[model samples]
Target: MSLSDKIKSNPSFKKIAHWLMIPTGQHRPRLWIRMIVNPFKHKRGKNSIIRYRTRLDVFPYNHFDLGERSVIEDFSTINNGVGDVFIGDRTIIGMGNVVIGPVKIGNDVMFAQNVAVSGLNHGYKDVTTPPSVQKVETAQITIGDNVWIGANSVITAGVTLGKHVIIGGGSVVTKSIPDYSVAVGNPAKVVKKYNFETNNWEKA
Candidate 1:
C-alpha cells in the first residue's frame, strides 16, 4: 500500500498526522504546514497561475495537481482534504468557484463564475450523530476535454461530463452526461447532442 493508504488504515497514525497538519478543531492547515511542507508535496505545473485571492485549503495527505497553463481565478476555493484534485492543461477555473476533490478536470475546459463542483458528500444516516462529525462519503467527478460549465452550476458527486460537453447556467448536474452533449436545469438533463453524421447539434 502507498504511504497515504497506510496512514489512513492506521487509526493512531491518522490521528497523529491529522493533529500535525491541522490545528485543533480548525479546518485550515497550520501556517508551518502550509508554508513548509505543502510546497514540497503539492504539484503545480509550469505556467499555472493561482490568483492571489484564491483559497487553497489543500494538505499533503491528498494529492493536488494543477496542469500547465491552467488558471484558477480570484475568489475561488479548492479543497482536497477528502480526496485528490487534478486539473489538466490550459483549463480556466473562473472566479468564485468551489471545487472539492476527488475531481479530475480535463484540458481546455472552461468554467464561468460561481460554479461549484464537489465530489465529497457527508453521511447523515445515523440519527444520533451530527452530520458534520459523521463519516464522509466520496465519489470521483470526471470532466472530459473541452467541457464548458456555466455560472452558478453545481456538479454533484459521481457525475461525469464526457468530452466536449456543455453544462448550462444555474444547472445542478446529478447524473453523468455523454460526449458532445449539452445539459441544463436542476438535476441537469441532456437537451442537445452533437450528431457525428451531420456535424450538427440536434435536440435530444
Candidate 2:
C-alpha cells in the first residue's frame, strides 16, 4: 500500500506521529524523534532540523525531499500539493516562510524570514466561475546553488533563479534571474551584476 493509504488505514498512528512533533520551544526535536515522526512524509537526510511550531502539509508527504543539514525555522510551512519539492543540502529556510512545490532549490540556499515561494497559481480565466473553483496552473520553480533570498520576498511560479543570485528584501520575483545578479524591488529587476574581471559586483 502507498504511504498515504497506510496512514489512512491507521488514523491513530498518524495522530501519534503528530503528537510526537509538538513543539517545546527550546530547541529542535532530536533527529531520532523526527525520523520516527516523519511529519514531512518523506525521507530526510541527516541533521535535518525543523524548529518549534513549524507546520508541514501532510497530503503530499512522499513528494517532499530535504537534503542533509537543512534547517527550517519556526512557523514555516512546506506544502507539496501533489508536486515535488526538493531542498538541497545546507539550505536554511528562515522563520515563517512558505514553500510550495513543484520547486527545486539547490545547495547552500538561504531564504530570509517570511519568504514565500510557490509554483502553482490559481486560474481565473472564466469570469462566470468562482476563482477558487477555477483550475490550478502549475509550473516548476528552480533556484540554483548559493542563492540568498531576502526577507519578505515572493517567488512566483515558473521563475528560475540562477547560481549566486541575491534578491533584496520585499522583492517580488516574477521572472527568471541570471547567475551572479543582484535583484530587488517589486517585479524584481537586476540592480547589480558580478564582474568576473574585477571580482566585484557592479551596477547593471
The parts of candidate 1 lying over 4 Å away from their true place are 1-9
Residue-level lDDT tens digits of model 1 in 84-197 = 999999999999999999999999999999999999999999999999999999999999999999999999999999999999999999999999999999989999999999
Best-matching candidate per lDDT? 1
Give the best candidate by TM-score.
Answer: 1
Candidate 2's error at 104, in angstroms? 0.5
TM-score, every prediction: 0.95, 0.80
Residue 27 local lDDT, model 1: 82
Judged by lDDT against the true structure, how good is candidate 1?
Answer: 0.96
Report backbone clashes per prediction.
Answer: 0, 0
- Pick out the ten consecutive residues of candidate 2 with the lowest summed lDDT: 21-30
